[model samples]
Target: MLSTSLRVAILIGIIVYYFILIMLLRQKRLTLKYTLLWLFSGLMMLILSVFPQLLNGITRLLGIQLQSNALFAILFFCTMIILMSLTSIISKQNEAIKQLVQYTALLEKRVREIESCGD
Candidate 1:
């Protein structure tokens, strides 16, 4: 069971995290699509913090020996998923950047050729 102080801390952390996320979104630093996952994570944390029994039940259902351990496991899994998603997005952007650079080079070469012919 989480102590009262621990629960309060978790609640405060969740609120602060949410505030930061909202500020980032308002400043156009974070896109809605990317923020969705973070928002969901914050909501889950808030729920778990507010209802420790829910987490306890989940830990029991998962056969986890400790509630804290179960919470860590869930957090680790979510982090890995978010990392993989970001990696995929980066990879796609890298491929697109490569293609754009090649296209630009080809266009430049064609322009040079046309200018030479005009000369």
Candidate 2:
């Protein structure tokens, strides 16, 4: 059982997390999807920190026992890392598409110039 002071501190931390998320969204620095991930992550942490009992029932139902939160934390970190890798992959693809568009435009211009010279 967490002390009342500790519970209040967790609440404050969650509020701060949402504050940062809102600021990023307002500043156009975060997309809607990313903003939602931030919100969900904050909420998940808030719940896990404040009411870990919720997981107790889940563990009971699943017939698994764990004493530490480290595994869950590690899973969350892995998910974040995967998301980062996916974002990088998408960025590289976008760069490739942009380069292709530029090269195609240059080729079209060169072809036009050649046709004009031929006439």
lDDT of 1 at 14: 87
Top lDDT model = 1
**What is the lDDT for 102 in model 2?**
100
lDDT of 1 by residue, 1-119 (tens): 76789789889998999999999999999999977878887888788778878887778788988776776787788788888889988999999999999999999999999999988
Residue-level lDDT for 9 in candidate 2:
76
- Show where candidate 2 strays beyond 4 Å: 2-6, 59-85, 88-119
Model 1: how far is 83 from its true place, Å?
0.5
The pairs that clash in candidate 2 are none
lDDT per residue for candidate 2 within 4-115, as digits (tens), equals 6756876898798788888888999978754565566677767766776666665666655662343265347757865996698699989999999999999999999999
